[model samples]
Target: MAFFRQLVGKILKNFNDRLSVSAAAALAFAVFCVLKAKGKPKFPFVNLSNFMLVLQKKLVEEVIFDGSHILFRCVNQAQWHVTQAEPMIRGKELFKSLVQYRCQFK
Candidate 1:
């Protein structure tokens, strides 16, 4: 997404006559970016910034992420109870361990 935005920005910057790059910064962690078109009568200030990457999930009986931790992974009706989770950059998860799982669902 960021790459596509940047690519478009570059094309618009070099070839666009009346296209002024407009951008919005999300409240979540994000990177705001803009085009840098030099040699203009007035130099254009184009910087890109994107704040955060979020992956929200809804489980069988509840909406997750309301709390600060992920207790389990709900794939369909199956819940892989997460006993341990490894930390990653910016609180993103890439690894987890579920040693023991118990579920009784009707």
Candidate 2:
């Protein structure tokens, strides 16, 4: 029990550090937005399908599938990592959706 508590504390500390870094980056981005609001060129609008297509091409460099979760590594030198928990639904719909998206994109 003591070991588990220490492990969880370390994990939370690491997560908090990462969150602070992300917050700083987000602040910098907001500064850029404020500057760009002054007579800057408008960015092109992207719809969900187009955004999904772009993500399909560049977002996931590798996928590590575990029993009930997935880890996705982006193509940016392992800088961006995402983990998603599997949805609880009848008939393995999450797996089916992934296959269907793969086929559709192909």
Candidate 3:
């Protein structure tokens, strides 16, 4: 996803007419958006005995998953970063992101 995003950024930079450039570049941009798959899990290793242990509370609240989009409210923060908001992941990725988000406190 990052590769495609950087590639699209490079592609967009070559175009002279930014306003009327809706040809091949537009299709490439569309393809980049479509590549938003549920990426691999990014959680840390945990011992078998401590698998159910939670170190921190959830930062996000009231998650709503209605098919395509996942909407959720964020808790108060000193700085509103990407972790404060939902990453548009579904099912497994959602769980991974939730874990990653809460793990910041630990």
Best by TM-score: 2
True-structure lDDT of candidate 1: 0.30
Model 1: lDDT of residue 25: 20
Task: Give a tens-digit lDDT track for model 1, residues 1-106.
Answer: 7886785566556454443323222311133223333322332221111101111222323222322333333345443332222232223332211111111221
lDDT of each: 0.30, 0.52, 0.49
Instruction: Judging by lDDT against the true structure, name the best candidate.
Output: 2
Write the residue-wise lDDT of candidate 3 on 1-106 in tens digits: 5986886686677567666467657867677566644454333333322321322545544444443433344466332212212234456566567556667765
lDDT of 1 at 72: 38
User: The CA-based lDDT of model 3 is what?
Assistant: 0.49
Stretches of candidate 2 off by over 4 Å are: 1-55, 88-100
TM-score of each model, paired residue for residue: 0.16, 0.33, 0.24
Sum up the clashes in candidate 3.
Answer: 0
Positional deviation of 100 in candidate 2, in angstroms? 5.9
